[model samples]
Target: MWSGDELDLDAYLARIGYDIERDGELAPDLRTLTALHRAHASAIPFENLDVALGRPIPLDLKSLQAKLVERRRGGYCYEQNSLLAAALERIGFHVAGRGARNRSRGAALPPVTHALLVVTVEGEQWLADVGFGWQGPLEPVPLRDGVRVEQDGWTFGIGVEDDGIHVLRSLRATGWMDVYAFSPQTYQPGDFTVLNHYSSSHPQSRFLGQVVAQRPGMDVRRSLLRETLSLVRADGSVEERIVTADELAATLEAEFGIELDAEERAGLERVHAAGV
Candidate 1:
């Protein structure tokens, strides 16, 4: 029920690094999905800037959508995915949120969970994620299994787990790596807030102690993490480097479109010092 005036849509597109025409034109199916994927890669950077900087990250829809689209900023999964959901809904797509689970930093999974989104396009269901840094998906993948799929030059596959849930993984040089698991359950916005609170405010949550980000292009992916900045090209060559504190700040602004104030900078310095 949020309305994006002309200014709002323009601002939102700017935040995500998109330049879409605002007239009443609807994107064709492939173009719609592609735009969604690219919009996610460019506009909503995978980041926990608020938590690391000791600020209260709002979980409300309007606030999040405004920050990401209207103000031209980046956010973590909850923020990014949520804003993407809103935009998709605005553009005539049916969407739903779902619960998920992830380990904190290098830790093991919580006995409980996290949150994600399941989108319905045409007659196919796809996984739409705007969060999860570095390893995040570039295009919405079919929520089915037993077949290999490819996008943005990377191959992915889904299969049934021992527990009967759907599992996804990526094919890498070494081998396949597990990305996440999901079920066919339907979910809502309220479900997401619960998971977001646990992930954002819990002391053991790695978002408070570490930094992570990712961006996508036609055939490459760029990721900025706690101690590494890497670019994975279309042909699978990965160029990486360790960044200094100054470089980290620069990357946030230059790549993610986040504008951190002086106080936020001091807070980020403390997070770097803590080093998880």
Candidate 2:
């Protein structure tokens, strides 16, 4: 029996631009691994438009799968991580869903603001992430603590801490900075819900006040519409332009693959008018 609230496997895969065999058997091997990488890279784009639109980001498998994979939506950490967990399990991969804290500042780390997958293949475990916006990993790497793995123009590694928490980071010009941390504890949907609500509702939350959206490809495309709209490329180059309501809608669709309704368009106009 399937978990009542679990996300659909086939639909989720299709949402990410992948077609699976309706009746053919899926084997656990490198072929499966490669397919997953391709789907993650191509199908679901990392984005934050829902938060800016004042819509509650859903963490349940079905809703998240619908938003990201069905309606062709984009989401933050919780939504993307949750759906990926469901898809990996449905395909017979041994997986673990782990919560992570963003401790880049060397503090006690924040709440469960991020998520990643741990899978055991051939007696080895690897960390897999496809939801992080611009700074996410492109492929799964060995889960060896404190070992560096080269990725797309970056180096990433995980560090095992004394408090039983694992720290993840990317190698920068200065040094290694903490990204997030996690443990072996399993995550329930409600955990993510609390964090999502806080991020969307809190007055201090950045998403509630700004228009931030990003799409990843050969380069990272980030657009921030506050005071003035700034479109930035991967190499730190930027293009500044003034946008009307129609132009904003067109930019959302053209840049982030997000289609807004009338209400959403009106809300976006309000944001633009407020100069935030």
Q: Write the per-residue lDDT of candidate 2 for residues 1-276, one digit (tens) a residue.
A: 113236566666666666666523455554565467546755566666678777777776667766777787777766776677666767777766677776765676356767667767777887777766656666676778778877545577988888677777877666777877788686665666676788778876656756665544444444444534455444446677766655777777876777878888888778766753
Counted clashes in each candidate structure: 5, 1
- Candidate 1 achieves a global lDDT of 0.68
- TM-scores for all candidates: the values are 0.84, 0.79
Off by over 4 Å in 1: 1-7, 17-24, 27-30, 103-107, 111-113, 162-164, 234-237
Question: For this target, which candidate reaches the highest TM-score against the unseen true structure?
Answer: 1
TM-score of 2: 0.79
**What is the C-alpha local distance difference test score of each model?**
0.68, 0.67
lDDT per residue as tens, model 1, 1-276: 222232244456565556656422445364676576666665566777777766777867678866766665678777777777776766667778766655323345653355677778777777777676666677777887775777767887877776667666778776676777776676677777777787788887767677766776556677777878788875668998887676667777876566777877777767765663
For the record, the alpha-carbon RMSD of candidate 1 to the native fold, in angstroms, is: 3.3
